[model samples]
Target: MPALDLPFSLLDRSRTRAGEPDAVAVRATVERAHRAEGLGYSRFWVAEHHAVPGIASGSPAVLAAAVAARTHRIRVGSGGVMLPNHVPLVVAEQFAVLESLYPGRIDLGLGRSLGFSAPVREALRTARTDPEKFLRDVAEVRAYLQGRGPVTARPAVAQAPPMFVLASGAGLTLAARAGLPVVVGGPVLRGPAPLAPYRAAFDDGPAAPAHPYVIVSANVMVAATRGAAEELLLPDAWAMAASRATGAYPPLEEAAAVRRRSLTPKQRESVEQFYDQAIYGSPDEVVAELADLVRRTGADEVMLTTSTYDRDELARADAAIARLFTA
Candidate 1:
């Protein structure tokens, strides 16, 4: 088999299982990173989700520190840290510290999302929803990282870690104006039309890249058979569907349990929609689909955000993806 020409990476949300403690999920994320480094994956990223029972990685910087310490080569970073929930200087300092310790292995992927619910947003003390403010904050964070801010961020390094925007909707424009690379997924992946404007509007700032870069993220799974791969996606799909219907993102449950639950039509539709957005199949099938996705989006990299209840199966899936490129 031919190798996938571009780099591929992993993003672990540290998803908790039904009976497991949150710590287990966090540790699993670190372990997954270790395995990913050995498997020849390009980067390993963690996410931030506050007060969510299903995701244990509320502090991406802290978790990234841990992952960085455990691995020697693979790039480690947040996929990303929510900008609305943080101060620009603080965000700069945290990543600066990570870069100080790990050198070139750190990344800072930022997003404008608030907490999952109103109360969580209240707890975070972030009510700002203005897109312009988010753009300014992103610029401020970049300024600090690049040593151009009025007040210098501490522990300043020779070079700042690279930054990326977790883009959606108007986020493409924000990233273009800010001149940062983008990690895009979800509805935007249905077609390639949205990326054209971003490329056209891209600004080549001092800290920005000369050209627009896109990383296509998705829930991808590979197994011995198509049915088996789909089964692995059930837990995450069910969790997403349940979260939408009940307003609570629960820990991942077994596929058999998900199969046993009788769902309302709306919930069933939600589950199907989740499946529709994902790419999962046997090895050959997945390679063809991912190649098609790269062709459509012109992505510089592919980031897998796959999660499942069984840790071993998840590991196997990661190995399978790695083999696709290495073989």
Candidate 2:
């Protein structure tokens, strides 16, 4: 593959592995961030997930602070903070503090994901989320960060931190209108058609650059061989299938154990679909796929979310991917 032009970032969800405690998983995430910084990754972002046994990252802002404290250069941020889960001002304050501590090295990526489950939704004291409300909430959060409203976010600094919107196609348009950079992924990003509208409608704002900036996210895994990478990816695929089969998301299982079990037709289908969406293989192959993806979408940056059950393998994969873009 040709040398990559776009910068690379990592999105670590701190996926909990079988028999591994949440604290261990979170510690591993921070360690991974440190490694990514050493490997020359441009940024390291964490995700927010609640009440899911498989994901240890519950509060992105808190985790962001942790990672930021450990690393000096790489930018740290949320792959997203689900805006509907908390008040807009509180979110702003959390990120405001992050920026104050890190200074010019923090990002605030916001999304409109509803709670992972109905019970989780109730636990958060949030009702069923409305799409319209999510847009309004984004505006409110941005307002607080910019100190545009009468209210001042505590510990205010000279400027608000940069923000990236994680949204669907419609949400992309909203981000464009809001004049913020956007992080978009999935099938829509595989082709040029969907992102055209986002590129056309984007308006330069004070927070982000005048030109539109888009970060494309994907599930990527790289290893010495194609089969080896696929084997590493199987645990997460099976876990996703199990989540669909039994409404209970479990921790990542060992690759051997997951491969030994028999999956129902539906479970098999889910696993296959999840596997198909990801980019996995040798470094050359993975880089080639990412290059094509960037070419199709005109992405300014690529954010890779690599989740595997083995911490050692996960770190190795991170290194291999880093070599692809950073070499």
Candidate 3:
């Protein structure tokens, strides 16, 4: 057995179920995380998003704190906190306080996007937006975290956690040069082209840990049968496909509801194609597919995330992946 180093984590978008008459979604989210922790998964991360009806992880720091307090061993932190949406000093103060409470277990993954639409982005952005603000902010954040400055973090602030970059495009190049871990992936469908560039850009200099680390979160959903898995995942795949086509955020609620209704022949064809290229399959089949992805990207650690809302399916999927690592 290779030992499961997949270090599965939840990249929660924070949307509740559309029509379920139960309150299990939120509790299930908590329990699902706890189960991953209990299963010896490595890290548990929540993303920072804003103004998306389907996403509740608008506050990664607060959510991270709750998840951290609930679980004991698993590393809990933001898969990212959208940096441009915040002032770096405020970001520093929030995370420093988190680190103080959960020493040696906090991680701060930063992304430059506002993580929302224009209006939402504008609302979240403070009155300051300099062109080189990220660089200046990052430096300030680094200083505040390292206790190297007189304007130290306040309000129960503590040591800063490891910083990472959630990168896409030239963002990878920047992360490497700046000396931070780069998350080469997330919810969107992926292939070798993007991951290769991200790996090549890394430098492993003083800004990063002794060894370079790359974390990629791939979309996956496992069910008892391939048909069932594909059936359940159409909404997520279709939503992404729509986002790709229009460069607009798809209505997730509408997308989810689409699954329960009959689809047009064209839409069905598109969803089927999407499943073929992205994620949709039985557990064993998914393992074979993802192992190939690992070979292509040279990912040091991969976190298989389920964008679908099926807790049992995700659990079964994890067990299947865990078995491979054991094998």
- C-alpha RMSD by candidate, in order: 1.1, 1.6, 3.8
**Best candidate, TM-score-wise?**
1
Q: What value of lDDT does candidate 3 attain over all alpha carbons?
A: 0.66
Q: Rank the candidates by lDDT, best first.
A: 1, 2, 3
What are the per-residue Cα lDDT tens digits for candidate 2 across 64-132? 999998899999999899988888889989999998899999998988887667898899888776677
Q: Put down candidate 1 lDDT per residue, 3-84, tens digits, no spaces.
A: 6888999999999999888999999999999999999999999999999989999999999999999999999999999999
**Model 1: ten consecutive residues of lowest lDDT:** 187-196
In model 2, the Cα lDDT at residue 71 comes to: 98
Off-target runs (Cα >4 Å) in candidate 3 are 1-6, 20-27, 126-132, 155-159, 186-191, 194-203, 239-257, 260-277
| Winner on TM-score (1 vs 3) | 1
By lDDT, the better pick of 1 and 3 is 1
The runs of at least 3 residues in candidate 1 whose Cα sits more than 4 Å from the true structure, single-residue gaps closed, are: none
Tell me, by lDDT, which candidate is best: 1
What's the lDDT for all of these models?
0.91, 0.85, 0.66
**Candidate 2, poorest ten consecutive residues by summed lDDT:** 187-196
